[model samples]
Target: MNKAITEGLLLMPPAFSNGLDQWSSQDGTVGSDTYDGAVNAAFVAADQDFGGCLELLKSETTQKLRAMVQTPLHPGCYLQIKARVKAISGNLPNVEIAGWAGGAGDVHVLDVVEAGPSVALTSYGEVVEVSAIVGTGARNGVDMPWGQDALYGHFGLNLTGANGGVVRIDDIQITDVTNVFLRDMMDWVDVRDYGAIGDGVTDNAAAFNAADAAANGRQVLVPEGVYALASNVTFESPVRFQGQVTAPKEVRLSLTKNFDFGSYVDAFGGDEVLALEKAIQALFNFTDHESLDLQGRRIELTRPIDVQDVVNNISTYAIRRVIRNGQFNVLADPAWDTDVVTSTASYSASTSTELTNVANIANIQPGSLVEGNGVGREVYVKSVNVGAQTLTLSQPLFGAASNQSYTFSRFKYALDFSGFSGLDKFVLDDIEFQCNGISSGILLAPEGLIFHVRDCFITKPKDRGITSHGRGCQGMLVDRCQFISNEQPMRAQDRTTIAMNVNANDTKMRDNRVMLFAAFGVWAGTGHLFSGNHWFHGDGETDGVRRAGVIFTTPNPKSTVVGNYIDNNFIEMTNEHDATPDWNNQYSFGGITITGNIFTVNDVAPWFSWIVVKPYGSGHYLHGFNLSGNVFRALNGNIERIERVDETYAGLDMSKSRNVVVQGNAFNSVDTPIFNPLMVRHTEAANATTWEIPTDGKLPFGGRARRVEGFVMDQQVLRGSNTAHYEFPYVSLQQGADQSEAHLKWSQACRGRVQITLRMDNAT
Candidate 1:
């Protein structure tokens, strides 16, 4: 047996000494090899109590130290990362030994060595295998760029929020030594320095050009400072360009121009023609070097001649030709406010007028009244100058706060990244993006790619915030994240996770918090898992009511939604103007296993309450769902009538979906017990091909279509495995008329350790 020892640390196996030569004592700041490995000078008492018995007091200068190990790693190698951590202070933070793969940019965070309440100073440290970062088995595999100056990278010891504590490590080795070669390796490139050109002073266009030029499948590190952008920046590669480090008080990143239309759509005649031609060329068939006739193809115009006509013609793409009206002479003639009459009371005609000497107070005016072709209604305008408008104005006129705190004007997306590809693993960590007042702040489409987002906060999403669609991407994990939206928190397009056109499998959404949105929070696609999330959708007078704390949609076959807490939602919608009418739409699934969750819906929005398990798109193949061991408290919705089921389509909608199992679930303070908990599918009304539910009809008997088959209905089904103390005495048949095959059996008196045996056999 070999024993290796350092100054204040001891370990078995001499291999630790070689691996730890790169680390020096904590006398001074650790060199670049160790980022900041200085033992806290303030930790005088703590360090002295290492092997001593002085009853060490927790020091005030608690700074966790991090170091990098100098080891050579190659392909096909298996490494066991072991760390012996002892927390001698109050609630010591978990000590982690992380492996940083150079090529693939992978950081495998190993098991946590924590000093729990049970973890004492004696027998405090133990060696455990966190995980294996195995290299590829291919012969021409990659070798970790070790020993080389540039190719080599450093692993960081993130003392995240670990104030004034000490942790020790030993037996850290890369074992199972099969070498993964360089050929089969995934190369990782991180933009270490995002060269900022303009300091919001000189010129920012160079910074954008340099960033766009250097934005590859790496990180574009933007130093914490003001980068004044004169023009729109286009990032055609997978890169992250960070702004200020300490989060700018006003706007960390400010584009010189208020709005850049050329950034999103090419208004230039040449580039637009080229893009159009490329698209048209793909559709046409050329044969024998002879060009086909591409004439007589006409494009329709859509923008209405005026503002009132805006909603009328949508399919049309005609741009509104604005002729500026005369400027208001506020100093000479204050004739606009009291007697607001002009060439045309319509804002449409006002756009055509030019205002030379008049100050464009369009920015500061509270609201404007414009005339429509028919009768003029009070249409509020949020923007003064068409280009630049305060982000606070994005809020609805009725919901505007009394004391407005101005931040920044609503700017276009900082970077238009639709053209960039191979960026599935794009990382935007440790940064802040303020819409300052923008819309849909950071729109991302990892679009059929694998990505990792950690330690990031995307706030002030004006509209449907942070919309992402992973059509066929897998292993997308969003960890330690936050999103604050005024509207819907997150919206995912159809078939985002499952194998629609691509396979979106094994997606993990964990450790996230969302606050106060208009609609659903964290809405994901089919065949995904949601765990360990704290969501709060506040129901106040200002915010419009939304759907669920976390809603999963579009018919997922097999998925698990567990360990989530949703409080104060759905039932809080009021009957007032634009209020979220229903609140308790919680934990509804067609073919899912919902376990270990809590939902609380009290007063405020009552008309819509209760967890609904309704089907989508005519309720087809909604089978094999399990609801077990969850708690629902303070739920109050209409006991008699569940809200509109087939409101989108005319059909005999299914009240209960097929093959659902509800077992070992408890409900408290619940007025309207679950009626048709499993909403089934039925035939649509004639002449209805889409989800257009008819309003006039009696809405069919028992709410919607249902199936009373080999399963438990109204009451909770008991599956004999769980250990929770639950009793279902009177199982009532909610909507079934005759003695159907599926019937509820009520036990006369269920006692203390009584469990129900519900076996769902598919016997026709």
Candidate 2:
């Protein structure tokens, strides 16, 4: 909006053709004009086609030709002067229309830009328009510096510098243009009033600040135009934007009173991307408010926004930042796509951090998720040295190997927090991330504390949802959240992405729903509580074959997976990465309690078990584990044992794994009828050397007997004739094929019946 001030009533007479009422001669006399200050300069009612004219005759350089305008003056007024002049006859005079400035009263003697081209009359019979901007700033201008007693400007035709000539000046006009600069009498301050040009060329930052400074508890109004704010401008007061502003993101603009996205929408000409970017930046900086409430605006993002890098990589920040109550729609822009690269690296058993001689090392970005054979879950690149062909990982990979090829997938998140290491207390609450089957959800801070994601919906994340690649998840909490993958419609075995990945310890995941990715979650850390979650991962698998619901990618014996409803999913307790069962005093797969869970499946696979312990290396055993009060039911056919070692490898080292618990579980349509320890009796004939006893495969792990008590009795005669004679048989145990049946050998031939008692106890 062109807020240029409107002119008031004419300062001159209503008509210059009627008579020179306010006009005067050079000697300051009204109705008296002199030729060369001595002879005829007169007002003509009609001269040729002109409506009115001030006819003047100029002959000498000392001759002041016409009268100056007499008008009322004000302190903060802009006096605009204009006239149409022409050099009519005789020697062409260097004549022009000019103005004079005065103080306190209308008394004369101040020439303001008299020689300026704006008021020059050069051609004969050709109307040359002349004008001047006069205000309290100068004799002619816009900015009004008040506090003066009074100021006035006088306009007239000048011939003092001209040779002998005749000049005709007509249509002299003047008006008070003070409304453009007047703000003290109004309720708001306009940016135009502070000399702001909205042509998109001039920097209005200073003018914007000036208007805000003069607001005086009133709203500062930015009228409609494209204004460039070349510098950082902060509006500390209430501001209304009918216009838009442009500035680089490097500038910090704090709209303290209106910090929400709605205000930015108005400020950025309704560009949602620009609006959201600034709003989030303001949120992280804690401008005005610590939390940026988007007010449920659906923002469309065409690119990834680096949360911490936009703030210049502070590396250490403790302010609580929150972004809530909105949804971000990811556009199908190639710049927002994930980066995937296959690289070869050399590893060592000494340290898993140095992945050297890496191919495509320069293409691997920092914070990229590392995956492949022997790579640990949730491992990411902390830094990369392309020249040295090495990548410093956030943590060690799972297994030890050399010259291995790995895939580095760097997923672009809607909000990336990978730049800072100590940005603690971050929150994303009550929001939705719509990845559109292309982008990911969120990348967490590298090393922060108390990162909480609650009451949010992560929809269609292409790679993973809510990743913790560093120690930022030390005490992370994900509560009442839902992760819906884009590949959720695919079968469990065909799904590729995971809903989440955890690395740091002491994290709690409660009451969250996962839409069944290939792996629901990749867990590494210990001391976690995962409860009240229903993670179903079964689809079109008639054979009842699927991946593990939760993969213990590392040794975690302190975590509890309890009270969950798992569908067609099993728990995988493995040391596939680091095969040391008791490395660094951390017991492998032991001390974990899986209780009070309901496991249900529809298809049939006789070998499909509910719990599988996979120990890749020798001597790796399950030192301690618990499985109690669980209900396992198969719909189609019978399954194998409820808990067993992976059939592909040798069973667990039973001598080292003595504290295994498998009891109090109700099963339906499963192969094993019961799992309680069983006892049996075997009768021996006369002179028999061996007595075979059948054990009902009721051992805790289907392998070895924990304890056995037995005694031999006389079977043939019912009573021995020599009762005092030694007739007891020496005990020799022979384990059966499946290790369920027990065989006993006798040192001497004796007819007897042997009663055996076997038991395995791990209730503690």
Candidate 3:
């Protein structure tokens, strides 16, 4: 392109009126006739239609003229090169308008001998127009006879015949007609302008970026083909996608025009699951958006969506990320089925963490729950050794002995975050998980900080609601959520799935509701605040069966269970982590505060207590246990007591447990006339010689009476004890400290109703 003429800013070669400046003939040393590859070349006058013309006298037929246009041809543009030519004298020769492709610095790349149809000059002094359409590429009706590179295109003329005559050529023209075939001229740039191939084999990274940079502020068009981008691509301008692109998962993409999932839905033609997967993958890898908004679309998945994978570039992300406003429904796919392994395993009391098995250990998942006869609750297989045929457990078994059949159940979650180890400040807000009775709600990361789940509904999960496999629940806040399990209509005793599982510490559960599960929440963590919750799993049956509403891994947990509506459920405290407290410090074991909670039973069992201490070993006792400000009511039968050690274990050692406060609780027709500090009243028989009464198994927490203080005065003493006006009764404590019974001997068996205070001793 020599000079511009404004036809799409078409650049033109110089006219012969300028005396052939920038035009040259091929030197004659090789294939041409003379030193200038011509016998003679002179600028001269021509017909009036042409201002002037160049006359070249070809001594030999191989002589030719060449003119190099330094400007590069636009990609996908076809240029028509034409010239008027006629033979002056001698035999007529055919002249062809040929062009050579150049790369850089006018360097010759490849030449095409026949750019267009060759025209033979038949008559002397007769004007004939010869034309050819040469294109930068072979697309858009331009065949391979004319193909131009990105840098330069040199237009030339060739004459053939042994006795070629003098020829005068004039009115040379080069016109850009790219838009005539590819598209109309517009304010946008096509990626093909920068040598982008749509064949799906060539990497389009460099070409795409060049087009984007050339667009400046204009829109970029990715025209139809499959383009492979081997590296990450960033676009600061708007882009229109008419083709698909493929890249590795580690390659991040920034489409500034449209970054929402709706746009992807449009891109993939309404395939929502694939759109969601792509959107989430973009969310984690790129810096464009910190949160992924599902826009209230219900995406159904046939398999679990693993959050952490090799596709993501970042492993430890402390930035706050949010995924909100979407409902995930599970479909019936066998991929949702969790792995389960059943095998015969033998456990030894001496080796609590190792289980010897003779089965397919390769099928056992490392994090599967280990359940068998004598298997402790909340025990999981930490690791599996296929060579040794042994399973390492997260916690030791309780009383595992001999060869027992064990079941290792691996849990599959709808949204699995168990792959990330250092993910923090991630929030899951306003999401509904419809598990469809096949999968669990969410599986948390193994190690993270402050994973918040709020305003969520986990409904009808087959296994668990929100489970923490490791220290992922550290500082986790679950607020304004509901966890209802698939055991909704099952009896409390028959239900097996738990609503929630907390494996880490410092979890704050606030304003949550739970319904119909074997256990409302079984947690091992400390510093938990369970407030404003209503947990019930009764199923309204008359069997009087109940489930544990609040269960702790350690009996002396430092937590507060307050303002909860507990119906037909009991609280169980245990030490499933270790059989004894020797492995832990005293500070790790703490007291419990169960106050301001409502405990009620509809058709209660005759042996149900509001709270029970279940320790695996005898060394741990209740410390700072407070059962106050709670109301226990029964509809059909009376509850035995407010609190008791598990009936399967021995009686509570009152001398070892201390700081017991069980008061301010109102019992309705149950635990009638309950008084704190272990008290009983009796009216002596008329004219009795001696009196002895047994107060065994009637006191709460298995209190053993230390001493009997007062004999209540009757009839006129203003119902006072230890302010008696009549003779005082002599009382003595019996069955001391080991059994919960008191023996009293009144003074000479007086015929008066006496009330004595049986002061129970407490351990320091």
Candidate 4:
């Protein structure tokens, strides 16, 4: 079940129904400005209690009004401060909600500001909410003033520079948003509070386990230290573990256990018993019934017996068998043959590719490629008319078809469920989980909900860093994290054993940094948003690692991937062998939006392009893609920015791929930009529609012989000397229309003396 963790209200007598007994106010005057406030009737009647509200008035000067409420606060928790304010006249006042912490000779203050003019305040006033995390790094000062200690603080609202205006404050509130699981459970049982040493050498796993069991559902605090675990630590119930509030509470949980998880084995009968035996022998090197335990009975096999003998023996004994960690391989069974139907009637060569059959046509599905032996052709099935006993192909047959035999093959995969399972409503924050040479860092099995992993560092895993598989694994958010040196930073694989089955959905990956990810950085399912994340491949070694930034493997309906604000992200090629950077499946069915991303290609390798769209099945189209406002910087000038690959090739059928907009992209290259052949194919056209070739050895009337559709190069600024002869259209068109090619032709005397600047404005 899904759970919404509510915040705890921290304001005492929040409404200000009484007087300002619980609040302290300070007024400062500068440049003939006066501040005035009391329980007044300036606020709206509905918001005021007892027909009165706290009002602060300023008159024609720089006046400051500070109203603060001192309260005990926990560090590292997010505090949401809200209030209702009005600007009676003149400029709107600047509002600041700040947290002040003082202990061990240090005073730290963090502020969240809602500047005056931006806050919409009129006679009716408006409610504004400002959120800030309370921690040492969030301190407002310029530098660290004193030594660090346990944080204790108060929250306050400061209204400053209200020139010639009266701003009233009412209905103020502060909330504790640290532990979403149990916000009201303030009675925390710390591991150190319950006889636990946080030294690096001591085993604190038992102490943490004890404190978790005894604290019920309260918060369990693990202070800033290195807590080592000699074995795996398991939590049986819901618990909240909070760390120090100062920095990212440096609680390192060192685990030293070999990973092991349960695996599922299917029931075998008939000829399947031999398949299972072969699979077991291949996976675990096991042979013969002497080493096997079936149905709690030890059966001796004297000779090479058929699978029917084992099935009869188990049926006679009235026993059931359970296999653990046993592999199961399923090949094509001769009993379930692929040759289901044959053509009953035949006809001569016709205009259409429809064939009549006497057998049931319900088995024929769309997208299935069927081959006709008589016609010597293979066509993709478009539709099957079950009532008419006819099947239509996407293309016409080459020749006439007689009675031809047809067969269909379906792909299958082995069942591999070797991962952890059964974790729910757990939050892993403010901790560093290092998997030293292990395959998986954390793998959630079939179903879980509301799993939040934020503000953590995961590094050095052999395989995936974090993965959530299975159905009902909804609302899993991985935010503000760092993953370093892993095979796949994060992935969401299929829940079942099928090859193309997808179950993970509604997962969000935001504001994470991945460095040196060997394979795909993120492989997510449908309805997943990947935003504000940065990925970098290996430092400088070009040893051919399959480095894709983000890949959407599952068939999602609609998704969005937005990048970081700056230009620090480097989307390297998919290793040195295949230089394609990223891949998106067209079968996702969902419209994908890729915007505001920056691709940095610094290496001097043969880079294919930024992204390639590969469809799952034949005739599948990539629809409704909006790729705009991205920057491509190629320092080595060997990269094709964007190439559309349909059916495993670098070509796109514009009729099938509909509603694609590629605009507002900037490309910076040290040398001539390498445009993909698919993008500049029109430049090689033999005929010109609007312009004529020149007779005299000069340039053509409109420069090139072809016009490129859906791409516009608006302006070209050429520099240097030596009379460079550039042949291109010196004209302008609509923003997103076809563009003419700019061909630079100069003698060897002007080789390195000229520079060209071309601007790509629109693409469709």
Candidate 5:
């Protein structure tokens, strides 16, 4: 494609005579410019003309007509102009497109190009096409910063060539040639071309591999069919895998088994015991292990596992033993060995992790992993007893189980593809990736760039749906995707474990839907944009910790999560983690923008809060935060709309937070608008004397002295409910004066339900 086909922006066949709304005559001498059928008849024979041509009758004076195109043309884009011209008397008028920078009256021309003549003109008219490559340079003796300045183009016709000259111009068009070429270029290879069948039973791994290899740098196409994949496929170069289906659920890449995990196993050695331990550790990353009594004998396997193991199902005690050849083994004990257990028990949808069975529960123990064969669910045993047959899980099960076959075993990650390098610009589109009890669905290498995963469905990953690690992985975009039934749907943590370490930069997650996520909907990093996303029923299970709608956790010394924008999202029914609340760890020196979001907490709980800005360490403090244009609805319990507390301080102390603006927020059924608490001590006062308040408005502290500043809460509207009354003077503050003994009380009580429009200045 040429530059004009890619960069030109004019619409095709721009009919002008129908209505001259965007067109204006430069000279009144051009008259009788009606959009009637007579005007259009003059250019009927032109190839580019459809109908409704602009007919101009020129008088004795010089006649000129120009129409402005409001579209902003980009620099480096080629412009293609086409028009049908019919000249009736005297010389034919010339046509040209001119671009102007700044505004009208600036008289600064950025570009000017004349239309070229066509072949032979008939009695009707002739079609002419002109081209101009826009550049950033002087045009018409005026400096043209093509893209830098506000620019518009004009299509002008000079009818001064002949007196009483009648000219008919139709099918005027302008096109962006450069963009058209890049968007419509079809350089691809179909996977079916590589002798593969989409019968949903054939293993098409080789077919995809071959197509990707043949694709070189072009896209690999997968047609609308169910393609079965038995193994993982590697994309070694910059290539896209496009499918013919509209949604990812249409063209499925069904995996019969979990992704391979053998790569994570350590090599076997002569030291059998140590090798076995390393193999187990490599597979599960178990924090602690011990021996447990089975019947009367001490079982030779790991036991009493760490919370991480149970919460993430990293490993199960039933299959805790690793053999000498680096293979896992599940031991059988007579005390717990019984027929395969089946349950007619039913469970309701709840955020609780406890399950009741009431029978045949003597064998189950803590740290044991159980799988629901009928319901396709798994859980790590937190507690069990023969008396109640109650099994508490580390995380809540989103769905109910009934008439399900329960199998006991250790949970190991089915998929493991990590530590690979040189995989860049890989695209996975229009495919459904099933994890089948794996830790992650897709794990990128530490070194890769421009990885795009769009229009995809990923489900049932034990840990995360999709993730990447280290600073080397950047420029990843995940758009129009759905992530369901995962612990953490999308995570890009910084330098943690394989499950938590994702330090990728310039990553974006847009137009995605995440549901039934047991943890944070998205745990992202610096330069990340989470926009137009819907997250529901999230943070259901925190494993006794804090959860959030979206957590931006960067390390200390980095004052802010740089260049992050979270906007236009709807989040509902997300439970907070034990200590951390929603939108956690937002301490970026570069500032954060949280706007146009609607947060609803229907299930009331005491730990729920809209936001918490606290210092994790001495150097870790929020530099700038802008919380505006957000709506909080149906919030229950003693939840703070926005709280600022430094865990490092026990009393009124110096807070490192600065440049925080909270405005244009609406709260409904909220307990407190803002909560800033300080603990203070008192001492005996000396002889009484008249004391005036400090000019600086800082409360004088004597015991455990520390300085504190007030925060501003403005432009907030709070609506009261009958169930919970809203109280006034929502700003709670504590100030100590003269080392005198006095007690300050901050109460949370409602006298009556009433609507209040409130504002607080210098509220500490």
Candidate 6:
């Protein structure tokens, strides 16, 4: 797919002979270069042989071969230049590539190590396709910084760098390479004379207004230059602020005010970059598009501050690399008031004295009226209120029939996004957001709109870093974003992290790197597709930082979590209830299509208790669940741990959960595949008695204690083992599994009550 659109000057001369004697002298020049009928003379040194030099001074000779082509190559067209080098002497010499356009500062070079030895006279030709420089200062994907004159072109085999080897170069040719195959994929427009609004001269405000005039229809180009700013600017165009240098180097975009990083100190002392501060606010709010793209521009914050927190200001991670001045610091504000209210239910003393509690229930909403039909089946406000931190669901009550258990099954919701119509697209490519607090990073109201965040880096967001509950927010895609945590700076309190916390349908999160934070890396809602994401834990919390690869509560119809890597998360972390629900539910939140994912851990096994397949409610049908093609590599054993307190563990729990298939996985070092045990906890309420039965009486007796005198009771038998029963199938290996073991394990878990299926393949 090589398309040649334009023709530029081509100047590469040809050479004859075999060794150094023919190329050492400047007087000996060859005239055989061609480019679209244009040709140039290739000069050579004399007294050098065509093929004999051995043990020659290579470094000194190469330093003299630096030659500059007088004419510049056109950037609008793709060009391929070929130079022929022959092994006229000893061995082959190394090659270096570099390009420069107009300005002295705008120059780029790519060093590639080619694999080739000496070539005899019979084998004397090889063509290499060098990759062109991208972004700014590049024309048609190639580096053409020499401008129209192209006088600064320099090319030659640096024989000086070679230790003692020598080679003769002949017949050098340069031409416009054609890419006719990909005419559709590439579009080339003549932008050589395009006008720029603000060449660092006009008002910054006016520049932004003109740039974003078309919203998502235009891509404003930022040429190489220094753009001084009196005020901040914003860009809403589909523009790319390509830079010639890294941040704070050649170009600078100075700010006027100070940015607050909460506890995280600022790089500049007390002083803040006012322009950047406004930009930070805009990025988080996703509103006010004033001054975001600072291409190749250095930004000087008014003051220097320290940055310790990494979870609150996820943008700080990108800003960190931009710091080039005095005492670069970080500043962040804390989120002391961010939480959610869950659902709860109660029962009458006589109707249902034995009541159980379930954390993080889904099928219920807030402030709703419910109906009932009989004595033991009534629907009240099925929720417990917890302060300002509350989450309101769409529905609360379930079936209120007397003949059967009431269960609220599937609850579907779509997040809304209002107030954001002027904005069309939100593209965050190659950007970084690092949080610096103990709270969430991004908290959207019930109506946040369309978003496309790609190639962005986010780190350590205090609570749930990014969560969405808004409306009109369709086509939400997060791809190639890096999510990590930093515990060194802000040690006061750890903000449990969830890279992407969204409750939306038709959502897609793909190819993201989620490192260890506080808790679950990705806690999603329903109707979402999570594919090819990498999740890992660096720290060894009895449970590693990530609690779940993808956590969702409600029943989702078409949600799929495929081709993800979830390993080493929630490792070594104890499952003892620090709170009611331990943090070991790394993959607790479920109701998803878990397929083709790799789960590896050393200790804290994957949670398969009430959390794994917990039901929606009493009579609701929870189906369409599939757990296939997932690989689990364990260093220690125990891949699954399930502890159920009640025999009737709801319609949502795995007992009643259907259509869950676990096959085509890999497991190592893990002793058992699954473990489930019944646990009984003491009542936390007041004194109550319903049924009293004599344990020692031989016959029917009431309120009478009978003692067995001849029986011997062992202390070990009375006090059961602390661990649960280890049963069920183990994870499958990728290479292939034994048919017998696979069948045996498969039958044990899903014989009849549930249909368990198995296939031996190397798909993981």
Report lDDT per candidate. Answer: 0.33, 0.68, 0.69, 0.40, 0.40, 0.34
Question: What's the ranking of the predictions by TM-score, best on top?
Answer: 3, 2, 6, 1, 4, 5
C-alpha TM-score for every candidate: 0.34, 0.73, 0.79, 0.34, 0.33, 0.37
lDDT of 2 at 437: 83
Clashing residue pairs in candidate 2 (N, C-alpha, C atoms within 3 angstroms): 35-39, 133-140, 133-141, 134-139, 134-140, 376-398, 398-577, 590-624
Identify the candidate with maximal TM-score. 3
What lDDT tens digits, residue by residue, belong to model 2 across residues 545-655? 677888776644488889988877778876654633334545645768888999887785787777777765555555557677889998787786666777353456554
Write candidate 1's Cα lDDT for 1-764 as tens digits: 23333222222223333433343232112243321233332222333323211111233332222234333332222223333444444545444343333323333322322111112232233332222233322112112212111111223222334344444443333333322322124332222122232244534444444544544443343433445544434344433333321111121122222112121112112232222222222112111111212122221111101111212212221221111111101121122122232221111112322111222343433222222222111122222443442211111121212222222122123222222222344443443334322333333333435545555555554333343322313456666677665443333111011101112456666777766554333333356676876566655433233354444433343567788776654311111111111222322235567778776654434444434433322323224555667777753442232222322312212333345555566657544333223332222222211212111212222232223332222333333332322433332332234212123333322112112222221211
The list of candidate 1 runs beyond 4 A from truth reads 1-416, 445-448, 469-474, 487-505, 520-525, 541-546, 570-589, 613-616, 619-621, 635-647, 650-658, 672-764
Query: Which residue ranges in model 6 land beyond 4 Å of their true spot?
Result: 1-292, 296-424, 438-440, 486-495, 521-525, 537-546, 569-591, 605-611, 620-622, 640-660, 670-764
Tens-digit per-residue lDDT, 289-335, candidate 3:
77777788888878888777633666677878888998999999998
Point out the worst 10-residue segment of candidate 5 by lDDT.
258-267
Q: For model 2, how big is the CA root-mean-square deviation? A: 8.9
lDDT of 5 by residue, 594-653 (tens): 677766654444445555433322333334455567776653333443333334312222
Clash tally for model 3: 1
Q: Could you tell me the TM-score of candidate 1?
A: 0.34
